[model samples]
Target: MKKQKIFALILPVIALGGLLTLNALKADPPSKSKPAVAGLTVPTGFDINVIADKLGSARHLVITPQNDIYVHMASTRVSKGIVVLHEEGGKTTIKTSFANYGGTGIAMGGGYLYASDKSGVFRYKLDANNQVTNPENPDRIVTGLVSVDWHQPKAITLDNDGNVYVNIGAPSNICDELDKNRTGCPLLDSAAGIWQFRTDKLNQSYKEGVHYAWGLRNVVGITWNQQLNQLFVMQHGRDNLHQMHPKLFTEKQSAELPAECMFAIKKGDNAGWPYVYYDWQKQKNMLGPEYGGDGVKPADAKYINPVVGFPGHLAPDGLLFYTGNQFPERYKNGAFIAFHGSWNRAPEPQAGYFVVFQPFKNGKPDGKWEVFADGFAGTEELKAQGRAEHRPTGLAQGPDGSLYITDDNKGTIYKVTYKK
Candidate 1:
């Protein structure tokens, strides 16, 4: 069955073997009413400003040295797919839009702008201005990736080397087996892992990608730490902990069972999802419900551990290893994660609709994670997922040591800067 599935994934390469066809973005319509940044609260020296608003489905964003913004829209009502904003005179104006498909991966590297949809990955050659030279069509870099409704965001990151890493996220809850431990996963060969392709290569398929790392389950947020020269990924832990294993975990435990993890990935490294999940409360990796060990048993010694663990169901959306000299000296080399907010933490108030800063010393976490930016939801308490006024979606560091965050809910971009 696995062999047949693999073959089915590859047979479509011939049909999509060329540059992707795109519809150029129309000029951004006038902003009748922009969101106010007064609701946001940052550090003492920092101020947040709402730069852009009314962007539909703004999922991921990449900022250029010129301070221009490129946003990948998962679904849009005003524009096509990817929208570009040109920054000038303390204002960001919509310049153009390109690409027809909508999904969550966008990155700039090696003079190219890379973006992915549900299934395939594409790149456009960037001109000296850091703008796409050809917005109508782009080189199809990788094709034939799995694109089911589950775990199919295709979040991407590129190392300093020529490698481009794409997440082939797992489509099912724990690989389709709920009641028992399933070894080898069988799905490992097709999904639940990061596939490494070449930034310099074109028209490559899944068969061409090297399975760089596995057992990640779903990785929506990923970044390459240039200082440490390593790839770091944020894994969204498995959900429905108590509903799946009622005998062992309560609803509260289910809401916070497995830890949303941050991992420093190396070749052949695995975080042991499905069979196990890291328990932040226990400070150890515990066997998973499907694996027959309840929630407290220790996982096999063979699996690796997380570098940092966050509470369950935070839905961490973006990760950045702060390399720029922006902000205070303490922020240098730290990790900033944007939690898009949680939906499954029912019975307990939904948390994590803000950005967090985790300080690091010599490439490892040095202190407890702290909320760097808050008030995104605009309410004192969160009753449910979409109840928040704004949901933080993406994170970007600007050219001049500033942090730029995106809100997919209201399509607002907030620029945070510090002054002495």
Candidate 2:
């Protein structure tokens, strides 16, 4: 009996050892049974390839001139919130992983690589090759940003001058105050907008930053248009229009009423939130139900309008302006947006699991937006059920003009190249 018990315990331990060895051998596991690019659809003459796989919550990424790719994760499980990749010959592999914190929004500017966690932005010194030399000891450029419950990721961008903008998202859905009457949304005093700070300043608090714009509920995708010399941002629209006010909006109307907007931002600009939402169907901004409009009343004219509006709840997460010569002339200076897909369009099929291209001319949108890449959800049924195998989360352009996309679901990285 003593030998029998000892044998059983050894058997279980042996099995566990085998399992761990197997997992260790398979460092890069496939996300699905199907090939990574099996269902992907891109425009003609453009082909897509999976450069890396199984990255784990890859959020935003930036590519250096030397072709080194740095991907940020929402968590630290896989790469400890940051993964640096390098490609040699035909294979791309993780060169190293660093950073103790993970969130989103990474960019390269002013000879430094800037990355943000939920509460602050940090920067690492780059060497002559544009590679981070001091990942272990990054400088805390800006600190003390607000983050509570919802809309907390501090998506960041930098301007040509010396300014860095960080998005301080609001915590409320509509600032409803639990259905109680309120005069004004006090949350707007500190959140729901973008704040600008000097890049040269280190360890700056929220009090030292200046409010660049106000009343923008949450902005994740922000960029500076080099062609136009203007700042652009993608605003996540409010939700639960029908559930909050069923008498005013039907389920279908709620699913498609408020449009996700792209705004050309300027100092003092206010894309009204908790008070109005842009109705793409009506081509007008409508008053929010929380702020005393039944759905048909137009919002006050003082509220600025978006440069372009898209279907609601699509969740625009990344934006990049293409200035690469690798593509045809038609793509020059166009905007590429990655929609992270939606989860809230219940009672209706969820939409937006692809990347889109918006044509631009003379520093403004000149044509309608078109689907540039698709098949991210894996299947039609999966998309309808809001179960995505992989969702595009961030975009970066290589020095050679190749476009790189990151998937947050499975940590997949895709590279798109144009061939004539």
lDDT of 1 by residue, 297-402 (tens): 8999888899999999888999998878768899999999999888888777888898999999988999899988888777665425447777887888989888
Worst-scoring 10-residue span by lDDT in model 1: 1-10
Question: Candidate 2: lDDT over CA atoms?
Answer: 0.83
lDDT of 2 by residue, 1-420 (tens): 011100000001011223222133234544433366455888877877777776678888999887788998998766576778776455665666678988998988888989999898999888898888898999998898887868888899999998899999999888886347756788887899999988888998778899999889898888989988888999999999999899999999889868999999999998888888999988898889888898889999999999899999999999999999998899999999999999988888999989999999988889799999888888799999999898998999999899998999977788888887
What lDDT does candidate 1 reach at residue 299?
94
> With candidate 2 superimposed using the best TM-score fit, by how many Å does residue 237's alpha carbon deviate from the native?
0.5
With candidate 1 superimposed using the best TM-score fit, by how many Å does residue 102's alpha carbon deviate from the native?
0.5
RMSD of 1: 9.8
**How many clashing residue pairs are found in candidate 1?**
1
> Backbone clash tally for model 2?
0
Off by over 4 Å in 1: 1-37, 178-181, 382-386
- On lDDT, the leading prediction is 2
